[model samples]
Target: MPYINVRLTRKDITTEQKAQIVREITATMQSVLGKRPESVHVVIDEIDPENWGYAGELTSVHRKRQG
Candidate 1:
């Protein structure tokens, strides 16, 4: 069995896109890692900009500065 955790900042990702990611991740594990699709687990976590930060600043602030 394989467990995969995917974390990303909250963005404009659609439900379809998330499903694609899950499918791809599971398929990759099954094909390359020899793990069964039924045994592969993919978990996605979407963090809020305020809760997710980099370079000593929050993501919300970073996006504002980028604008």
Candidate 2:
């Protein structure tokens, strides 16, 4: 079984977009590794910007500075 994890900061992501992501990932596994679509697992994790950090600062803080 192939497992995929997608992580992103909390934002306006639609259900349709998530589904499309899952579909494409599964297809890629099938094409590249010969893994069955049914055996591929995709998990999406949405984290609050405040909890995600980069460049020595939180993403939420970074966005506010950009604005």
Candidate 3:
């Protein structure tokens, strides 16, 4: 069995997008690790903008600065 954890800052990504990501990742894991998709566990974590940080700044702030 393969355990996968995916974390992302809270954003406007649609459910379809998330499902696609999960499907692709699961396929890769199944091929590379020889694990069945049904045996793989995928966890998607949606983090708060204030809690998720990068480059010494929160995600929201960082994105705003970059944009």
Q: Give the TM-score of candidate 2.
A: 0.96
Candidates ranked, most accurate by lDDT first: 2, 1, 3
Candidate 1 similarity to native, TM-score: 0.93
Q: Pick the candidate with the highest lDDT.
A: 2
lDDT score, residue 39, model 3?
94
Candidate 2 per-residue lDDT, tens place, 1-67, comes to: 7889999998999999999999999999999999989999999999999999999999999999999
Q: Lowest summed lDDT over 10 consecutive residues: which window, candidate 1?
A: 27-36
Candidate 2 residue runs with Cα over 4 Å from true position: none
lDDT of each: 0.91, 0.95, 0.87
Better of 2 and 3 by lDDT: 2
lDDT by residue (tens digit), candidate 1, 1-67: 6888999998898999999999999989978988879998888999999899899999999998999
Model 3 misplacement above 4 A: none
Q: Output the better candidate (1/3) by lDDT.
A: 1
Write candidate 3's Cα lDDT for 1-67 as tens digits.
Answer: 6788999887887999999999999999888887888998888999988898788888888878779
The top-ranked prediction according to TM-score is 2
